[model samples]
Target: MRYLLYALTLLLSSSLLFFVQPMVAKMVTPVLGGSPAVWNTCMVFFQALLLGGYVYAHASTRWLGTRRQSLVHLAVMIVGVLFLPIGFEPPTDATSLENPALWLLGALFLGVGWPFFVISTSAPLLQKWFSTTDHPDAADPYHLYAASNVGSFFGLVAYPFLIEPRIGVQAQTTLWMICYVVLIAAVAGCALALWRSAEPEAAASEASPPAAVLPLSWGRRGRWVLWAFIPSSMMLAVTSFVTTDIAPVPMLWIPPLAIYLLSFVLVFARVEWFRSLPVFTLFPLTLLGLGAMLFVQLGSPLEWVAGIHFLGLLIISLVFHGLMAADRPATRHLTEFFCWMSVGGALGGVFNALLAPLIFDRLLDYPALLVIAALAFPPALYSRRAVQITLLIGAALAGYLVGRDVMIYLGLERSRELATLAAVALSLGIPTVIAFTRARVLTPALLSVPLLISTFYLGQPEGNELHAERSFFAANQVVKTPDGGYHKLYNGTTLHGVQAQDDEFRLVPLSYYYLTGPLGQLFEVLSKRPERHPFAVVGLGTGAIAAYTHRGQEADFFEIDQAIARIARDPRYFTYLEDCPGECEVILGDGRLQLAQMPDERYELIVLDAYSSTAIPVHLLTLEAVEMYLKKLTPDGILAFHISNRHLDLQPPLTRIAGELGLVVRGRDHWVDANDPVYNLYVDGSDWVMMAKNEEAFGAIIDHPSWHEYKPEPRLRVWTDDYANIFDAYILDF
Candidate 1:
């Protein structure tokens, strides 16, 4: 019963710590540009606070002793509880948006730092306190860490699936307050129970048997930090890449974090046979399989690609953490060990969130971190000359693949058959090398040499890029087509906009806003509107919508990313903003926040292009946002939405929002045939949704065959500021 109490305290603290992460991220997304980096930056802040808490735990245990520290912790918990129901709003001014990462860090520090720091201390401090108790496995309280992670896993898994779908943030906070109050009592009960049995030190001599304790060195401590750092960095990198590139599933960030926590649970459990693996013998297999994904494309499903990489994450965590656990210090130095572990985690967050973006122009952090992970694991398998020979052969095979790119670089004519042969060679060679590389005779240092070489081969930046830039928000590029006929703009993996380079088509819109698309037709339908009110575009993707502005009209473009705004205005890449017939003003800030500040009934037409395939300004599509848009629109004005998602089916949510607000909505899934002459100018298929106060506001387009009325499902609730679930809208693209 006493052990159960200790475990439950650790579990509850961990649950609260993790559950608040995604919830707070959701709150701050609209303010921080809604870039994927928002999550990474938030992680760095939490990891730093967690490290501070661990330091406090270690210092208090040595100086204050268990009895005095327990009283102080109770007081600290009371103080932390005062900062309950954590929440914040988007800053009102544009000054905070100028340095969003630091502003976000400062905001989070004020909002949730105290409670997070207090909760982080519970795991290390409670486990250390339990070690002095008279429980059977008190000497090996590492299992308590496993139970803590079990609770963490539950917290992450529950938020997207169970909590966010049904409960609003306010209600979730209320429930959290109830759970926390229960936890405070549970902790107080633990202190009383410990005192009732005996004083903290009275049973320590009996509970902790005498054993030979080794002296700690900086070198040994560093090994622990490295073990923790690789997994932490890899978790962020994997989540960033997979969410943007591979699966693009809704709530995709959850699985990577879940894998991270589950790895800790599997590594620290007391069952030796299940917890420990011959990691050195199996790690190369995981690495080679992951490497093959870069070179070979056998048309595997998106889920399978994401799964293989996630499996790699799990295996890498197990190997590194398993070794870290095996090197655990005696019970006296346990708190110090955990303190260093938190240091590694904080550094990992800094590297991925702060440093990597500045250092690399492209998304190369994942493969670089993979190389580091390969070298960090100790090679324990045994082999001789045969393994070295096999590795050399594999290196030669990779060289052959590299040679093909060199041939292209050097202006040699390459055949299609040769490309297929090189890919097949790489796919076959990776597994062959993995089989022999597991032997103990080979060193990991030698293994990283080929991977380092392959990073150069497989991870080079794209070619024909006329402009490449990145911001805290996202990485973007402007590339010329191989034929030099058009320029394309890409935001990460999603196409943002495009423009034709030829004089005949220079001023024409392309890609999603091509002259033949639904947007073009909508503009044609609204061409006869009285030229009194101005126009507003939420996102400034290459400023393509500016082409719709007439000589007497005005258009306001709200763009969050400064780099994107610059590229959109640059005539070399895109000229829509420059060549517009009327005035074009670029307002630099979040679209929703900027829109909320404008006067009511201000615009005749409002266009929303703030969504991508996966990452989106979720706050922009809610009931409150729609209501705000309605207030900004004239009685006969129309709202246009670019709903071109490859994964999420957002129509149902918009339909429900329309039903609740008594608005009319219609959409077109426009498919353009490549056989058309417009295809030569870079026109593509697009999906668009348009809404209005009534069918009369849509004018003639409402009756056109290209547009269909949206059907609302009574089962689907309208999304609001407090409740919106992307998981419910996820569509299986593969």
Candidate 2:
């Protein structure tokens, strides 16, 4: 009965400990882009604190002994409860946003530090406590630690599915407060158990189990670091590939993180069934075979391709974590072992979040990290002749296909069909041989050969093509097409530029939207006032806005994507340069940053057609950002915000910004007619919000039904770069 109380205490303590992780993380999600980096950074801080807690636990067992340990831990619990309600208090200044990691770490330390430290150390400390108690055959505390993680896994899984969807963020905060109080009271009960079951130590047996020992030497720690680092880094790399290369969706962070956490379940679970030899024996074969497949880029039909890669990474991470878990020591050394592992995890977070973006112009870290992880986790079966033979053949075939694809991409051959077929065959053939032979060592090398080749092929055209293609925040592939003697530039998912194919198309902006809507109407009006008609475009989708410029107007294009600018201005991609002469200049960097950098400038018409809910960078809609836009515009400048969003009703925010800026606003929705040929005469609709400095400008565009008096809702808050509350904005019904 006493041991069950200890067991229940450990379970409840751990449940409270891990439940706060996802709850606090979800609270911070709206402030940060819902990127995996948010979770990774949180893990770094959690692990760092965890290491501290473990060291304290290990030392208490060695020096202070069990009785004193209980007093100290219970005292820390009492102190920790003072900072209750699991949520961060916003920092006092804006500079804190510059390095949110340090701020978050400090905040986490203050808010839950004592409680977490108390609870974290308890896994080991209580186990030692259980061993000393008069209860015969105290089950291994190591198994309870596993039980702790099982509770943790439940917490992680529950947040997104059950808790987050049903409970409001505030409700989550309130619930955590109630849980913490109950958990603390439960711990107090355990402290009573320790005091009541007291024994004058079988003094010989109670003297701390000879200071827990480490199995590995310094050299072995290096190997553990390597083992830990590769899988940790690969987790981030897989997310990059899935999110960027496959599908650039907002909620894409969930799958990769879930996969990464599942590794812990495999590694730490108390169940030993399927936890041993088969994993190690088959590990080499699957590593090389799957590793190679992951590296290869089979283009298009990608709806499920990303899923396949995610699943492959899941298998790899699970395999590695299982191997590590199998080798882990008894309860006494568990904390120390995890402490060293934490170092590797922290390094992985830094490399992916901070270093990779600045170091590589492209997502180079994805394939590179995969290759590294493969090498770090090499299987023990590399000495077989049969495996060696299969690997060599796979490598040779991949080499030939890669060579052929490179030649075609380089214009060495114009036959796209032959090269395409050859590339497909190579991608399939190599994986089959590696799978058949079970050669793990050859898997990484084989996979890497194709991936490296694909990267070069993709990079070569991107590097060399100036006019139609560029990669900045996302890959912008622009293709030129001729329509009725007009030249048009198409961005990956949308058409960006439309002009005459020859000098004829140059003066005529040709798309359905550009030729008929408020933008098209604004162009017609600007033709009469060139000297005073400077126009600023927020996004440089295809440099198409430049095509709308007339003889005397000066235009500056505010483009956030470097890749889009490179391809949009390239003569090969479009005739933006050849057709629209000195009327335009491209300013590269984030639109908000560049505008903030600019001198007091006024545009006759400023386009706020930034993305909204879809791929809309939310930073542009913040009160702070809109204020910057108002500063850069003329007194009568028409602020046209593209409010055409599927999920977000941005008109409210735009209206709020207009009210704050003391301007009047109107909205217009434009579209194309299926049978219109004159194009200019096509009926148009747009949810364009036009804000101005006076009543007359606001009244001028108010007749449209979409137009409404600007009103800000009490619950409808504006988002800023430093913070955004997307949980409030989640349209679950929609």
Per lDDT, the best of the predicted structures is 1
Model 1, residue 557: distance off in Å is 0.8
Please give, for residues 1-734, the per-residue lDDT of candidate 1 as tens digits. 98899888888888888898898888888686456689889989989998999999999988987667888888898887888878786787877788788989999999888888888898889887777666667676878999999889988888888889889888988888777778788878777665655534544533332221545889888988998899999999888877766645537777888898988888788755433555444576566556555544222477788888888899888877777777777777879989999999899999998998888765667778878987777655323343354455555656666566667755532343344445455546654666655555345665565555545544444546798776787778888887888788888778888887787777788889876689888888778776557889988988888888888788999988888899998888898899888799999888888998999998988999977543777789999999999899988888998878777777888888988988899999987788988677678888888999989888889899989998888888778888887765656564
Looking at candidate 1, what is the lDDT of residue 488?
87
TM accuracy, model 2: 0.66
Candidate 1 has an lDDT of 0.78
* Clashing residue pairs for model 1: 381-439, 381-440, 382-439, 382-440, 382-441, 383-441
Per-model TM values vs. the true structure:
0.92, 0.66
Name the runs in model 2 displaced over 4 angstroms.
1-39, 86-139, 194-215, 280-303, 381-734
Candidate 2 structure quality by residue, lDDT tens digits, 1-734: 77777777776766666677766665554344334445556666666666677678777766876777778877777777777665666554334544555666677777667666766666666666766566653433455555555656666666666776565667776787787677677767776777777553454333332223345677656665666676677777776666555543444555665676666656566677534555544444444454455435453355466666667666667666665665555444555566666567667766765566556655566666655665565546233543455445556655665676677666543334344454566656765766576645565565455445444443433222224332323334433331344444433333445555465555454453456566665555455543565778777765666667766668888764555566666665566645675478887645666666666656777776564312445567777887788778776666777665444456665566566666666556665565666554223344566777765444334564544555655555545544444444443222
* Per-candidate local distance difference test: 0.78, 0.59
